[model samples]
Target: MRQLILLCSLPLLVGCATTKTGLAPEDVSAASAKGDDVIWTDAASVEAQCNAALEAGRAVRDTIVRESASDQDVIRGFDNLSLAIDETYGWTQLMFSVHPDKVIREAAQGCEKSLSKFLNDVSLDRALYEAAGGVDGEQLEGLAKRVHEHQMRDFRRSGVSKNEETRARLAELHAEMVELGQSFQKNVLADVRSVKITDAGRLNGLPQDFIDAHAPDDDGTITLTTNYPDFFPIQTYAQDSALRKDLYEQFMQRAYPANGEVLLSLLKKRHEYATLLGYPSWAAYVTEDKMIGSAEATDAFIGQIASIARPRMEADLKLLLKRKQQDDPKADAIQVWDRFYYVGKVREADFGFDSRTVRPYFPYEQVRTGILDLYGELFGLRFVQDKDADVWHESVEAFDVYTGEQHVARFFLDMHPREGKYQHAAMFPIQTGLEDGRMPIAALVCNFPDPSKGDGKALMEHKQVVTYFHEFGHLIHHLLATRGDYVKLAGINVEWDFVEAPSQILEEWAWDTDVLQRFAKHVDTGEPIPAEMVKKMRDAEEFGLGANVMRQVFYTAYSFYLHHRDPTSLVLDDYTDEIFRDFSPYPRFDGSYVYANFGHLIGYSAIYYTYQWSLAISKDLFTRFQSAGLLDPVVAKHYRESILEPGGTRDAADLVRTFLERESNLDAYKKWLTE
Candidate 1:
């Protein structure tokens, strides 16, 4: 999913050099209408034009800062800056999308590397934050000041204050990391897609739909692809124990090729970069701006969750083992591949709730409406469908997000799967806004099963429902940002860890009876989810939670350990695998090279813990609405004012404090996990 999110900006290269004649936003819109001829992909022309535009934007931005300007002027200047940056970013991204070859990818990374220096020149702290302990009054207003502080901490943590030599070194390391990251991903995508099975009997335990989907010709066999949708179900359901073991080993070996070297290089560059910036490790560098302050804090938090979860996980395994025993009196011990399949079966037998029963009620359009209905009820905002939107894809839909009469922003919803498009759920900020008379536009990019699968019905599994709501949370944050004169202040241009809370909180909507009742209508029957079924759903909420939670903790811990620990002290081959050992009961699989494929360490660095940390905050924050009704507009409006609209315009911690009337507590998360 993360890999696909990286491709959303590829369309920016589709347009011509942005008209340099100081076109107004209206003029830009008029120009964009002549669309297909815009030629930003010419490598030579794009670089020269982009540099010129960036220089002009910088001068305008500086003037805004230096003049002690009027509110309106600052707003206008910020909007202009946003427009300039957006053009450059979009142009370069288009090239990468069309040509993801090594050369094109490198050039795109280089463009980003170059543009970053100009756009982020001013320290985020001095520009927006009050408590930055630097110069004062540079931030635009109360809201701007809050955003500045948040931005400032992020810059500081990212080593913006390093001396020129170290900064240069860090930049070089970043470029290398980008190259390696791309390489790592390309390898995994190819490796995962390359796996094949030649025997028909191998499909023995697999579902009829899966086997039918992948059936081979003359060979009388079915070949499996390593996509999560394909890989996970086979692991869980395949009756052939030997086949499961073979698949598990094959799956784990995804990083086995030159990926070990890739991981080592990435680790080395990260460590050197962190050390150059006076941080003890990359974890410290990354986590400084996150919810958890250090690697130690994260490990401690993981330990706290693990203490309760491990025991429950043991109990879960016992239940699964008993079920397997009933099948065959002399059955051997259950292994990793058997876990999901047996657990899912046990869930149906014990709790009587499974995804197949729930999926029919969640047609694509109804789920989307449910999301809007949930947000409208909670946030006092509405989304009106706009069929005339300038969408890049035919399957994509657009909407105008509104707060009463004011059109807050525009959102493009690309919900179905396609060739050349990314295959996951993610939010992309197509354009971020500013108080300076500019509005942001965002895209919710999701790869739901293609329409052909169910005769054009957008039937979604429960997991997909959660994913939809989650991505929409991010869209809400981006569209609702009413902060500074700059686009960066408008949306998720904040700390990574804090970013997930908004999205994760919305996932709770999928579980709520009150919320689900409004949107969960059967596509053919038009009936609501049964109350008894909802009860069963709630009763089974914590099912497999132990395994799920542990999986996240492993990823988070691996993220921290990889970035923060001293790479020189350990053998690079064992780096990523070693991190998983303490968290999981099993030892590391020798053949798989996970770090080679772990791309989050590229964009997120040491900050993958954001998901877990945000989950904690989400659990606590949603408790407020849980106490009220999920749709209680009064509390919803309060959330909009305190959290959603603020964007990066305020400290995430302070925002939570103000909204919840105190610091967010861990008790709620701990209880949720234990239950």
Candidate 2:
């Protein structure tokens, strides 16, 4: 699974030290303590909460504006206001994705629109900007100074100093962008496409457990959905090319026709917003604060990565194309539908491995427990299940994190797919940790195989196991990075491009033999995965490294190019084809509308290159463990303190340097690409 850090652009508001409303400190603490326990019962409840939060936020704004310049009370007032919005709008934004009920999710969307409008207004408030600017950076040190600088920077970026008319229009643009993003995501979530198989023999080469779980319906046809469990198995194992092509088309065209206009309008608005802020394009404006720093630099970095991987990609394509020719003597090129199947065949033929051979040892339940135990041992933390906790779905499980009897954080696992649920794996922040004893809350919404079906084993693929480790890395980042004084500086609030590194680094554990032996046991045989099989798994994993990197480059280019220029005359389909032809190793499958269902096009926008960018840093960071050992507690503790605990208090580059004792470089990434 691609790890998504869902940090909606809402400003991080930390806890306030004092409130001018004359409310007691305990009352302010109580207000900030809302977390996973707050449930939205209906649409009306969402609206009611939005209205209340806006009213209270306005009052806090007034109090901050009244404070004297250079007074510490101004900072407290801003923090109080931050807490108010986070407790209300932040929680609602998360509910919009994972809430089980349709009415509640829709209500949450409505609430998000209202909250976006309020945040836009707050961002443009010249009074608040002036008040924050009055703070003396010379009097502050560390996190406080960093937070003040960020507040000023965001204020300027928001166009708080623009003419009144331009500011009003900017507010309108922000609101529209929020609504369009919600529509784009909802269309993808609500639109779950499927393919029906009439002949059972079409399922040749699939694991028996998968076949058993997907038994035929009353009409003797097996149905497959675009969800990962069904879609991936068929693409990798099904012998019927027509079936694979049909499913691949459906999967790619997820929210088509509906989201077609929605995406274009979003791009147009984003471009206009950037232009209004005196930038040439959205890509230029968005990258200004990231590690890459500029659109030219982003282009250069992508070119560097593509050049490094192209040779390997060409070689990998030759091997896959050769495999395809065995089945079709006249075949000249690999189709998008043929890539997974042919890759699997090549792995088995060359590396003496098949992904299916390891499924029996990785039942869903054991993998979950094994990962929990692994993290607990490495981080000196404990996870205790909260069986009676309130959850949006009965299948959802909640756990509390403790460090030797001190409850430090809470997390929820909604690890299976259903109607109206988020269709991808991501970590949603429910509550931001505060310096004054408030624990953070986060949830992992994923669509893996559910054990409720068939023989109840719910065996997992090696890839899915790696995904689990990746997402848990995000959860652990949010839980451990709680020492910052401001919410914006705390948790996984690092630079947008750097957010995926910690999680990507954790994926290394999934490939380790020692880690797998602890939890990956045959469901029936009661035996651990053999060490030799793991060796084959590791070797087979490298078979498609070049093609995989190129595919990511294709996505990064698609996202960047769509926003780097004017979109009024751009045709979405033509643009997608152009990007694919330039960067992808495989030919584009006709009729596929990849952009319509690309959720990152809304959240990450032009910054989709962050994945590859962060992967480079992750590869460099993992060298610490490669030398010390995968499970070295001393290194883990040092990393937790240096990289995770500081959160966004310091620059991300500084954090990397602190951990590695040198500037981050592409040497590790280049080595991994060709090795």
Candidate 3:
């Protein structure tokens, strides 16, 4: 997942030449340039820093709205406002997810709420709207023109033209929604559920390293948390049905009782916010600016994909049921807990491949280095570790990206699990790059196996390697795409529905035999993975495609419908179960509350369908690679220039058309699903 913290759209309200804070102009410029003053250890400093930025941003806003302001002045002012946001609210938002100190995280969350309210108030400012609207579009060219146009559009969509009373109510609703979103996310981060196993024998099918990592305590019990490092192995390899079921349910119910009302409140507030703007529902308002264009179009797309996936999903279920019958002849249906185990069984028995056989070749450190080398070779870039750089954690690694001698960007990898850290994998942008010499900074926050523990060999599942590639895709996209002058058009600031395409397309490299052999050497023998084994691995990979696509469809529908209609009489738990039964191949578990822990509901809102929509675009994009050869530098360079370097300066459809020399369609995506 690519986690986007709002930075560019919010305008400042007050117009003043002097800032209230005592900090000098040079101090503010240096702080934004270095990108190192992000971490906040004390709660008070978070508030102080945010207040200072707000003062500076107000001054910029004031200058933009002045009578003597020119087109160039307006553009610079908006860029300066973006700088203020990156220095303050943007950094704090990242800290809220990755910071080690709980007190600091909570403080950052509070600052974020304050910033959100400020943004809401300013977004409704009539003067700011009029000033932005007054920009001469004919005077601006290229990205400058696009930036001016987008700013005006955002102002209108933010209810800048509404009456004072209505705008005031919208501001209150915006603040409440932000508060509820933070509460919902915080509950999931704090609630790390675990199950203890009294009998060690039940851990039979799990890998030796996993068992070694969780050695029993003096009380003779092994405890497992719902973290990815613990949860996924149990789901795929654990032999005990009862144990898997217990862990599965516990994992699904992560932030249950706490987030239940929080989600409901969020949905209700969002619906009201949309209706106030004259939209029927939140989904309708949110999708209007996206590539999908409208809620009805989004619904039709979901239906089309679901229909295409249903046949494959049913066939995959039959395979799983047949595998399950060998163990329990009376078994009539596969349980949710049974899906992973049986899929692995079918792959090993029918496809002549076992996932465990590939783990020894994917120790965490080797895979990390291999990925960097592979991408560097393909893209004509270099990565050097920055040992002197400050990091939030000792385990975090920082690096500088360069194209030949010119430094292009910086990134960090925090790729292990800890208490209170974000549980899933995501790319968090820390700083937006600008042509004015500020380099983009990003961080990949993931929960992969730690090489420091368990005999010093953190052998990753192949799927984890794929996830690493997917996330690094996002990191590079952020770095490579932000060479433009405007922060609003920088990084992955493309349309919401198209943001995942670059990342999803990169997942293809993870499965390539030529690519894997470069890094996937055995932990003990140091020999490259066998080509025949890679072939079998690829074959097994296709086995569960139908079921997987349907699962995504189910999530997309759930996210959409939750905001697509009135929530005044909706019940979160009941609605979740109902959606599951309607779209999912597997029956919903009796007591499961999956929605409570679904963090995407908070960040992604009604646009979870973006994943699949972008996947279709990605598949179409990959055809050029398929013909030109995956590692062809000419093709890669063309792709970088045509598809990525423009960032959000051009419409996403135009970028795709430029790269492929034609409009993108679903032909490639349909082939991928049915073949």
Candidate 4:
């Protein structure tokens, strides 16, 4: 998701927009387009073109209002204003992370501030909000009405009806929050840490290739960082308790003290802004715009599941305790670092499977083909890489998405770790689709394994393979899906809670035996992962799953409590320790800044609960796939039309109901948890 709900400019009403919802295809390119052909050779050229478009948008907006443009014309003007800022700024933000040039990155940071201020002004404009007077919403239909209603709703949430002084203050707060959020992410990237493994004995359980990748220090020690590929392998395999503890502490302590104050400050401003917007708290403020409708409702939803899941979580913990006690008679308690360690042991003891067992058959190239081929087979689409296409980095690849003969979108793939790339997996929207011919562009930024590990061939763990499928689910959603009004109803624009359904449903394919056998093959032998092995692996995958789901419950509760309560009472560490300990099956570790590593605390805020909330819906969706057959084109087509294609044009519940032909329930989710 772009997450520019606040940064994006909403439609400013005029008679023009209501009367002329759109232009003829021929008229759009000649009479109305701006900033569509942005050249990226230099920052100066980009800035000048963007500024010109901004000026043009302003002039056209003035004319539309002055001339009392029709409804259709007003919508067009709003779209133009949005595209000018979005097409220019969106690409600039994408380049900031992936572009190799530091100068361009710096320029992007500066431009982001400028764009933030501009967006704040638009959101706070009294004249624009007044022009967009409240409507019964019966006059328009489809995306046009969605855009109209959302525009008015956005203005209200942005405090457009508030007095000028208060509105101005809110605008300032919005700008500050953007800078704080950027700084929060930058701190994480800037604060990388590592520890050296001084003894070979400490690396006893790790794979040879993993050990070989690191250049031994002069003292013959292997240095490892907090990056996922390195960090996860260590936790999954390392036999030495001391070494695991060292790595865990270093990883958990990232972005603290540096981001501690930043997080605190961000929450403060958010509370103030939300307060000014007439909400009692930021949770309420954010929830008003989401499908859940209220903070209390979201809490009740989480509580309902937590009540059923607690005992299941406790049962899973007994297995962890049994394994820990077997390792040492004196080991009565599981520490934070011991969860993965003990879980790995218990998994091997019970299921005869581990990540290392299947890594051989799940090499990088095959995984990519398997995902693309599966999507192509089911969705009637093709993904073609333009090796020569201009991109921000050497590793970044450009590809076009097509449904049969029609090209729908372009996406860039930057799927490996680097010195300063974004550390998580997400689909960044570069440009949004429009009915006016501006095609959508998106980028999938992930820190999946690269050549640094071994042989320059990335072999994903089964979990990583699922992650790949999950993130690409978001990408295909952005590409295959189209909305009439692109701004309000484009890719990943559904309710925050519902956005994960498409991706989570796709993840189930990774666990399916038929799907795995279709493309998962050994790098050396070209043999598909054995059905027997995959079956065991699939069952083993659920080992301790209840505890894992409970962990999400903890994260959601911690975040919700922090935002929904008084900000003055927040002591970042104490609040985390208290709430996190409630759901954690083990004791809290010392000096652990787990909150700092949680990017959602900054971006997701109250919506962290959405992952679990969406998972319930995701599970329900996969039941349809399971019954219909994994590769059934008819079911896939129905999902595309009913779930993925509608975008934000309809409410998420409505979309799900239309797809399932009945109201959704948590029965599938409960079955998943109990199974």
lDDT winner: 2
Candidate 4 lDDT by residue in tens digits, 1-675: 111011111111111011111122222344223323333667786576556545655665564465466776565555555655655556666666656667666676666556655665666667666656633357867677777787787778878798879978987897799899889989887887899867766788888889788758788878889988888888878888778889899998899878888888999999999988788999898888777899899879878778767887889888788788877788877776777888888889899886677988787777877888898888888899888786667777788877778777788888888876656677766666755456777788877777546796687787778778888887787665566755546655677667777877788888888899888888888888899998888777778787777777887787787889779878887887787666665667788887787777776787777777778888898888889898888999999988888777789999999989999888888888886
Q: How close is candidate 4 to the true structure, as a TM-score?
A: 0.86
Tell me each candidate's TM-score.
Answer: 0.82, 0.86, 0.85, 0.86
The alpha-carbon root-mean-square deviation between model 3 and the true structure, to one decimal in Å, is 5.3
Cα displacement (Å) at residue 453, model 3: 5.2
Where does candidate 3 stray beyond 4 Å? 1-51, 88-90, 94-117, 136-140, 182-234, 238-265, 387-396, 416-423, 447-458, 568-578, 592-597
CA lDDT, every prediction? Answer: 0.65, 0.81, 0.81, 0.73
lDDT of 1 at 64: 56
Query: Where does candidate 1 have its weakest 10-residue lDDT segment?
Result: 13-22
Give the worst 10-residue stretch by lDDT in candidate 3: 11-20
Per-residue C-alpha lDDT of model 2 across residues 1-675, encoded as one tens digit per residue: 222232222222111100101111233446456354677778888888777777777777787788553446666666556665665665676688878888989888887767666666677789988888878877977767777777777787898989989988998998799899999999999999999888999888888999999999999989999988999999998888888999999999899999999999999999999999999999999898887889999999989998988999899999898888888899898888988898888988999987779999999999999999999998999999999997878898999999998888899999998888777677776676766777788888778889987899999998888888988998888888878557667777778788878888999999999999999999999899999999999888888888888888888888888889999899988888888889988888778888889888987799889878988999999999999998999999989989988887788999999999999999988988887
Error of 4 at 166 (Å): 1.6
Deviation in Å, model 3, residue 206 alpha carbon: 5.0
Per-residue lDDT of candidate 1, residues 132-153 (tens digit): 3343536556654553444455
RMSD list, candidates in order: 6.0, 4.7, 5.3, 5.4
Show model 2 residue runs off by greater than 4 Å.
Answer: 1-36, 39-52, 67-70, 98-110, 176-234, 238-265, 386-396, 416-420, 448-456, 567-578, 589-599
Clashing residue pairs in candidate 2 are none
